[model samples]
Target: MKAALWYGKKDIRVEEIEEPKVIKGNVKIKVKWCGICGSDLHEYLGGPIFIPVGQPHPLTGNVAPVVLGHEFSGEVVEIGEGVTNIKVGDRVTVEPIVACGKCPACKEGKYNLCSLLGFHGLCGSGGGFAEYTVFAEDYVHKIPDSMSYEQAALIEPIAVAIHSIRMANFNTGDTAIVLGSGPIGLATIKCLKAAGASLVIVLQRKSIRQEYAKRAGADHVLDPNEVNIAEEVKKLTGGLGVNTAFETTGAKIGFDIGIDSLKYGGTMVITSIWEGEMNFNPNVLVFSEKKIVGTLAYRHEFPATIAQMSDGRIKSDGYITKKIALDDIVEEGFGTLTGPEKKKHVKILVTPDKSLLSD
Candidate 1:
């Protein structure tokens, strides 16, 4: 089996390794497609953020040089002992979250907030950027037969967008402004419209990303570099600002723009896993009586997300911008996604099976 491993910052290598086997309470999957995620890019560019270097992850007990992908889907090739619900040949995608059940958050059904929070790919148990990977049965979800392998691979990120919308206080007629138009940002735009948000405004500067934002259902797209974001948002919202705002850029300026673009008493959801500190005025939230909330990974939103995509409420057709074989993952996949031409792509899916590679 060939797998991509994260050794350190900007150090992901594709090497041949022993194929993973099914174990009690888990299943082995013949991976079909896996998407390179923003978090993965963060680890590759400026990491050790979640890739545990100094010591083993408290839950998985795995450290650096771990297998590096989670946004993926595949066919169940083998089922482990004690696993009954999942059968061989079923199409599925793993939730990828590794949470400690003993935590207070988990006890209350909020596993994403568990004290010992970890991820399958980042913290390791082996990941999907390989020909075969094993997953705990409890974390895998079956997909409808109508969904394609490429779309199934995106369930994890789409789940993120759905979960964020479910966490907010917006309703059918409400409006929102999303800062940034990265993968997660674009996913958020589609989810917002599907959830019935009256206006879906996006702030993005890159020409490629702006086009994606529109395709993702954004009603209006603006570039902060060319205009005043807050002012333009106010004008669009009749000077009251939007009912809610989502900051997915993970940049300090995104925080500023998100907070400034909300109406008094409006809510703002921070969905990005930032790598650094951000400076902002506390008085802004105090004077307006507005609130800020944070969302981690998905909770009980996977089923709904799958349904939305299966029925066409949430679109995934144009999200995948490129695909490459495992052999070219570094140069054609991650390298292209993280280099100067980064904005040219929306999502890149890698296939470990060479037979599926396109010429």
Candidate 2:
């Protein structure tokens, strides 16, 4: 079997590797498609951040220089002992987060905050970049026959969006302003709309992304370079601002813009993972009674997102911009996804199994 291995900055290699064996209470999946995520790009550019220099993962205990990929879906090739819910030949998507159920956070039903929580790709456990990945049965969710593998690969990210929206707790008919037009931002738009948001205003700089956001169901798409986002949002809401704002660009300017676009007493959810701190005005938040909330990786939304995709409530086709074989993972997939062509690329799904790639 062949897998994409990460060593250090800009070092990704596709090499032959031993296939994983099914273990007790674990299922072995033949990876069909995996999406290149923003976090993966971050690690590729300058990392060993999540995977420390010489120390192993606190939970998984695997060291750095591991297989890299998590946003994926596959077909079960073998099932381990006592796993009765899923079986061979079943299509599935993994939730990725393997948490210690005994932790205080887990006990409180907040598994995302588990003290010993770890994920496959980031922690060195063989991940979806490989031909086959083995995982505990509890992390797998069955995908309906109606859902395509590319779409199934996206459930992980969609679940992230769903979780962020769930954190906001927006009421039906609340207006939302999303400060980015990347895959997650577009997914946020879809999630907000499905959550019954009356209007969604998307702020983006790139024309391609702005067009893509509108196609993904944003009520209004504005280019921040062309117009003042806060003023436009205020005009849209008749001098008031959006009830909810999502900051997904991970840019300091985007954060400021999102904050300025929020109505008094409104909620702002920071969904992007920023590596460094940025300056924000404390007085504005204090005076307006506005709240800023942060959302981490998802908890318990995979199956729900898959169900939504199967029922046509959320369409993944518009976001799946490219598909390539495992052999072409580095150049055609990762390169195009992170390079100057990023705006043109949304979700690039890589398939270890070519038969399933087209399916």
Candidate 3:
């Protein structure tokens, strides 16, 4: 089997690797489609962020050179001993989260915040960037026949958007703003509209993503480079500011704008995985009685996200911009996504089987 493995910063190789075997209570999957995620890009650019290097991950006991694709969907090729309820040929998507059940957060049903939090693809346990991978049966969710493999692959990110919205608890008819027009930002825009937000604003710099933000149902798209974002948002909300704001861009400027574009009691949700620390004035929160909350990945939101996708609340037509073979992952997949032409793409899926690649 051929898998894309992370060696170190700027070093990802797609080479032949041993196929993962089925363990008791686990299921083997033949990967159909795997999307290159922002987190994966971070690892390739400035990491060891989540990829354990010197020592093994506490949960999966794997280290550097780990297989690296978490956003994936596949067909169940084989089922392991003691694995029930999931059958061979079932189309499914892996949740990919690695959490210790004994952790207080896990016991409280907030497994995304587990003290030993990790991801199957990032921490260890061979990931979905290959022809075949295995994971415990409990972590895989069956997708309806109506959903395509590409849409199934999107469930992970859509789940992320849905979870962030759920955390905000934004009321119907409330106004909201989403900072950044990346994949997660686009998903957040769609979810916000679907959840009955009366007004949804998007902040983006790239022309391609600005168009995507509109297509994703944003009521307004503002380019920070063109106007004062916080003031513009305030003007749109009748000078009261938005009821809620989501910061999906890890940039410090986006973070500051999101906080500043809030009502006296508004909530700002931080959804980006930042690479560095941020500096902001505490008086902003202290004076306004505002709240700033940070969210990790999804927590038990996959099923609802799939249902939303099936009902057309979230469209998958334009989200996927390109597809490539496993061998071309580094140059075509990662390079195209992070390079100068990055704005031209939204999501790029890679297949381990060359036969699956097409024009």
Error of 2 at 64 (Å): 1.5
lDDT of every model, 2 decimals: 0.90, 0.87, 0.91
Q: What is candidate 1's lDDT per residue for 1-359, written digit by digit as tens? A: 89999999888899988999789999999999999999999898889887888898999888888999999999999999999899999999999988888989999999999999988888978888989999889889999999999999999999998888878867998999999898999999989988899998999995888988888899999998899989999999999999989989999888889999999999999999888887778899999998899998899888898999999999897899888998888899889987888998988999988787654
Off by over 4 Å in 3: none
lDDT of 2 by residue, 1-359 (tens): 98998888888888898898998999999998899887788788767666544887777777767888999999999999999999999999998886889989999888988887777777877899989999989899998888877778899888989999989988899999998988899899988888889999999886698888988899999887889989999999999999989999889988998889999998999999787778766998999999999998898888788888789887776888888888898898778877888789788888887776556
Q: Which portions of model 1 show Cα errors greater than 4 Å?
A: none
lDDT, ranked from best to worst: 3, 1, 2
- In the predicted model 1, the residue pairs found to clash are none
The predicted structure with the larger lDDT, 1 or 2, is 1
lDDT of residue 314 for candidate 2: 79
- Model 3 per-residue lDDT tens digits across residues 22-43: 9999999999999999899889
- How many angstroms is residue 195 displaced in model 1 relative to the true structure, after the best TM-score fit? 0.5
